[model samples]
Target chain A: MRAQFVLSEIWIGLRRNLTMTIAVIVTVAISLALFGSGLLINRQVDQMRGFWEGRIQVTIYLCNEVSANPQCQENGPPTEEQRAQIQTDLEAMPQVESVTYESAEEAWQHFSERFESNPALVDAADPEDLPESFRVALHNPQDFNQVASAFEGAPGVDNVYDERQILNRFFDLLSGLQNAAFIVALVQIVAAALLIGNTIRLSAYSRRRETGIMRLVGASNFYIQLPFLLEGAIAGLIGGIVGSIFIVAAKFLLLDGMQDYFQFATTLPISELIYVILLSIVLGVLLCSLASFISLRRYLRV
Target chain B: MVGSDTRHHNLREHAPVINFDNVTKRYPTQKRPALEDVSIQVEKGEFLFLVGPSGSGKSTFLRLVLKEERPNDGRIHVAGKDLARLSNWKVPHLRRRIGCVFQDFRLLPNKDVFENVAFALEVIGKPRRFIRKVVPEVVELVGLEGKADRMPDELSGGEQQRVAIARAFVNRPMILLADEPTGNIDPATSIGIMKVLDRINRTGTTVVMATHDAAIVDSMRKRVVELEEGKVVRDQSRGVYGQAY
Candidate 1:
């Protein structure tokens, strides 16, 4: 029954200071939602990496008679025995998942189809300009370095290269973006915390006499603090709901509808979006709780 | 001193709700002690008053009774317990036994007279049914029956003081300490507040009122302790307000 009185008083106090309570909720919601967005982007980047790395292939170009690159020292094409021997060596390696040898003509056709978007590059380059390559898919992408090292001085091998460097540059861009998001989230969270603290302090000050009278009337410390704490909590909850609605709207109207032009699918899904909303509520509670507690401690003698 | 060693023996079973013994209290920023070597005693059902001009330390004496401040030297007691040694943990419990009324009324602006009186019981965790019965009774005792739902600002100054007195006595506290219960009210309202307090005193509750109201003190002729510059100049039974008026 005593607990009920305390809870009821807290309810009344929050209702009395509805505006400041709403402010705290908005502060927590907006900051947490941004934090959640950064998290989602990081997760998407991880998914994309896992998807592409599984299909990545290691390529080894064979030396040709007309080639002048230092590693391709041979003046004539390799015999069928040499080709068979190379294929056997690659198949025997534990790291090599599969092997497919493409002749020079096949390599040229692949190049033409890949560069078909740029007619000038495809029309200007001859088929002979490209190399006859042996493509090897590895069970472990990390093990590509070991296989490339093994084929370093093999006969008919011009160069052994892994696609990891190209993938690294692409991943570097996404990683940088994720870092930028984290920095933005950090700065905004601090600002929100300070705002919450100040707002609650003002509210507590406005009702200073009330707090003192509560103490005189045998109100426990927790009882006196409950209303202010709830005030901030309600604010955080409201802010979270508002910010989450904005986030969902942004995902629908901006990220999803116009993503085809930019080809960036970093937008969070509806389920994940719901996860962000839940995150906002939790964030709102924690931030407002902290802010209100700190504010009450500083301002109210209780 | 009212000679009653037999009553003193009974006080051991039920503590004399307040005690002070050569208690001297000086504020941190003041040159003189706010209360100096003050010693007074009262039986469990006694009605008492502290009367003095402003700055005569009557307010300070009342504050000490409440343990809002501790004596810089000597001892102070309330409800048979040492107030000086009470930890922060015990302060609230000590407060629960005492009902205090301020000169300003200090009523909550948001609450109506019903809630105002009920608030005292509510803080002490009275059940809803008990509150529903006790609140109206106390409100009627203060003579504000029709004005139960009226806000503090809506009431006149005397009516607000009545509401405050109702709040103070609502819990049936062991002691009721009123600091200028009729300070802002007219003489008629002052008589009303005194009458209500007299009824509370009749109910075996100890009442200590601190005020400079000459007419009320002389008319009631209760025991009055008059102070001047932190010292008790006179202690009289059935005393008038005296020269300070």
Candidate 2:
């Protein structure tokens, strides 16, 4: 029966301050959505790193007659002895997990297959024109720097390249995006907290008379505050539901929409989406309750 | 002091509902204490009038009894519990045993007469079945049985006061405190309010009232404690409002 009274009080408070209540709901929804997006992006970056780190290799391109690299001028099409020596040194390095020697013919065939759709580029290339190289895979992909420095300026090597370096730049962009989203979400959360505080203060002020009577009638502090706390929690719950909807819409329209185009990068799974939604809802409810509690402490004596 | 203690002991045997022993209350912003070393005792089932001028500390006396404010220099015991010894958490329990009515009739404007009265029981977590049974009885006691559905704004000033009284008494408190409850209504309506209070007191509930209603005070002929400039100037059993002037 008392719960019924408190529920009715909460309803009356919300109805009386409908505009402010809506403002709180919308603010919390937008902030939680941004927060959820930030978490999702972090998850995506981790997944992409897991997918790419294993396959990334450091390529040591040996000098060839067609190579314009300065190292090739002194070597003159790289003697077989020089190539064998370079291959032996790469294999002996502790940073090198394993090295595969790709001859010019094999390099040409791999290149042709990669550009199979672009016949014009494949026709311009000759088997003898491709540089022979060693493809070195490190046990730890981050050891690319150690392997690259070891092979650079070697006798037969024309250029040292780590494929992971390119991928690192891509990941750096993603990390930057994640940080920006988190900052925006943080700002929005602060704004939402302030708005919730103001809304609660206004509600309390407008109902001061009722509270005064409640005090006179022997209402406990908890009894007086329960309705207001529930008011904030209800608004937060609605905001969480809306935010979850936004996250689901974003997953469908943005991530799942591009699933076929970016097959190499794995899409976030359903479990991740569910986790984000639940987290956003919990965060919303806690944020609102905390804000309301603070305002009540500062503004309402009871 | 020894004689007063013996007197208090005798009153305690009679179940003194309120005992104020040299209670003094001073507001920091004021130059003088609101209540100054005033001692009064009210026995159970007594109807007492606290008559005083605008700043004679009548309201302060009621507030101290309610535990709304502490006495700076004395002790008060209500229903056998020492006000100073009462913990903060136990204040609501103290208040639940007492009912208060104000000059403004402090009814929730949005709630109807029945809801306003039922609110008292609801806030204290009374069962729905009990509330359904008691609300109407109290409403009928205040002679507003048919008007229970009317909102505060729709009622006359006297009816509003009746609703306030019903809300206060619905909990069946051991004591009722009225601070100028009839101040806003006409003389005719003030009598009506006093009769309701008198009826509630007849049920063995102690009644303490602070008021400026000279006519009602003279007509009721109850015990009167009058204060002047924060000091008790008169204590008379079956007193008139003033010097019969």
Listed per prediction, chain B TM-scores read: 0.92, 0.94
Which docking class does model 2 fall in?
A: medium
**Each model's lDDT:** 0.79, 0.89
Q: In model 1 chain A, where is the ten-residue run with the lowest total lDDT?
A: A258-267
Give all candidate RMSDs, comma-separated: 4.7, 3.8
True C-alpha contacts between chains kept, each model in order: 0.47, 0.68
Residue-wise lDDT of candidate 1 within A169-266, one digit each (tens)? 87787677668767876787787788878877777777777777777777667767777787677677777777677667645664466445546445
Tens-place lDDT digits, model 1, residues B115-191: 88888777666788999998899899878889999999999988898898888878778888999888888998788
DockQ for every prediction shown: 0.46, 0.62
Quick one: best TM-score, which candidate?
A: 2
Put down candidate 2 lDDT per residue, A1-302, tens digits, no spaces.
37778988899899999999999999999989888887887888898899888888889898888778887887777787888888888889887789999998899999999999999998987878888888988888888777778778878788888898787887787688778878988999999999999999999999898888888899898898888888888889999999888888867785666455556558789999999999999999999999999999887784
Model 2, TM vs. native:
0.90
Residues B103-182, candidate 2: write the lDDT tens digits: 99999988899889988888888898898899999999988989989999999999999999999999999999999999
> With candidate 2 superimposed using the best TM-score fit, by how many Å does residue A81's alpha carbon deviate from the native?
3.9
True contacts kept of 2: 0.68
